[model samples]
Target: SGDLRIEMRDLAVFGEESERAARAVFAAGKQDEYWDYHNALFEGGEHRPKSQLDDDSLVSLGEDLGLDPMQFKQDMNSTEAHEQFDTVASEGQSIGVSSTPAFIIGGKPLLGAQPTQQFTDAVDEALARAES
Candidate 1:
């Protein structure tokens, strides 16, 4: 449960929108080690990017991360991983969220890429409300 992943789905970064680096991260995500790819992108943000996740680069990165190239390839095409990811997305959509990083805390909605302080303050308030 302590897994962190960043997804860039439904994207077609070709032509004028050829973000090869960004696409590479998404392509890497197709593998089980997408988290590594994501963290790498974040760490190297703007310094050097792929503009899109090319297959060759994704494979190379997975190998660089010490992931079994074969397993990573298999997992990428495996229905199990995609289904698991899709289930969460589908559940979120059913629950009135169409965007990313949606949350439910103390029965209240906290949506989008909110700051840590906002969540911390909300949780603190929620605790107070529960106490009262």
Candidate 2:
């Protein structure tokens, strides 16, 4: 994976609850535990239904990740986190993304949950372009 650099952009296409959870995850990044919280959110399965990601669940996930509960709560509700989420969400929209799990690989849009081979092909194509 050394040849690949992945960046996550949180999009709030789901709704307000989803937006809040997304912001909380970004706030967790401030504590250097983004991936930990991220993994915890999806720990039980490959995909979690939106109904299972309420505000209380989000905070609990943070605490389970050993992030300071009070600090995490404050950060999750902070203006900074809201703004950061907004910025990324807007950027995703500007690029014509209108759904969850949309990916822009090598400046090409790959929408939805794709097969593993599709990802490998995209990465290989991108690598070739980079080398050229």
Candidate 3:
């Protein structure tokens, strides 16, 4: 239903490595394993260093996940993936989303690490707006 709408955007706010990591996720998406790849990157920990998301590690992770290494590499460097990531990054920057864990609810921007109740309140606010 229209209860909620969630969208994932790639904004390379962390640095070059962050951009590469986002591209890797986009590449995995081509193989229908975006979340799998994304989760694996974060599996080590939430504060996974940029080295962990390097190109070699990303390709290796794809191999571990049974994705064809060659195809994964190609998709990871593909123009389409690059453009998709670049577009989202630019759009997000334009909208002042220059950090991780950003959210836009009911046309209001919420940034940084938020508590559970904050999200609940955002949702309630959104629902209330819809009703009015």
Which of the numbered candidates is closest to the native, going by highest TM-score? 3
lDDT, model 1, position 114 = 95
Q: Candidate 1 — which residues are off by over 4 angstroms?
A: 1-35, 45-51, 129-132
Q: Tens-digit lDDT track for model 2 on 1-132?
A: 588888888787768877887888887898999888877766875656777677677888888888888898889989999889888978888888889789888877789999999999998999999889
Candidate 1 is scored at a TM of 0.57
Instruction: Give the lDDT of residue 55 in candidate 1.
Output: 50
Model 3, span 1-132: residue lDDT tens: 779989887677788888888898889888999889888877866846877778788899989998889999999999998899889988887777878889988777799989999999999989998999
lDDT of 3 at 105: 85
Q: Distance (Å) between predicted and true CA of 92, model 3?
A: 0.9
Which pairs, if any, clash in model 2? none
Residue 86 lDDT, candidate 1, scale 0-100: 56
Rank order (by lDDT, best first): 3, 2, 1
lDDT of 3: 0.86
Clashes of each: 12, 0, 0
Candidate 1 per-residue lDDT over residues 25-105, each given as its tens digit: 444665555668767645654433443345555556667887677766566445654555556556555666665456666
lDDT per model vs. reference: 0.56, 0.83, 0.86
RMSD of 1: 6.5
The deviation in Å at residue 81 for candidate 1 is: 1.3
